[model samples]
Target: LSSSMYEQIFDRTVSVKQRDREVSSFQLTYWINWHRNRHAPVRVLIREF
Candidate 1:
């Protein structure tokens, strides 16, 4: 998928995850941690490429 598509999916998924956790105060932390973890699969895909 295109980068924008990836971003949309990521944003939606992150929002859902944050909602599930109900940690509005720690949103920045959750975003950072979730973002870090989310890149793992892309890294693997890059390596494969």
Candidate 2:
């Protein structure tokens, strides 16, 4: 996804997450494997990897 999309996700998710006590910080991780020729996989940062 583009940086613009990432920015939106960052803003929206943070507010929703604040309602819960389990969350600490926020992070966005992505990987592009063109060899697979499929969509990228994104993992939202949780307490663990």
| Best model number under TM-score | 1
Give candidate 1's TM-score: 0.45
Give one digit per residue, the lDDT tens place, for model 1 in 15-44.
Answer: 676568565647746665566575634543
Backbone collisions counted per model? 0, 0
Candidates in order: C-alpha RMSD to true structure: 8.7, 8.9
Residue 44 error, candidate 1, Å: 19
Measured by TM-score, how close is model 2 to the native structure? 0.38
Clashes of 2: 0
Shift in Å, residue 16, candidate 1: 0.2
Give the Å error, residue 14, model 2. Answer: 0.8
lDDT of 2 by residue, 5-49 (tens): 754565465556565676554322221223113332234333213
**Model 1 worst lDDT run, 10 consecutive residues:** 40-49
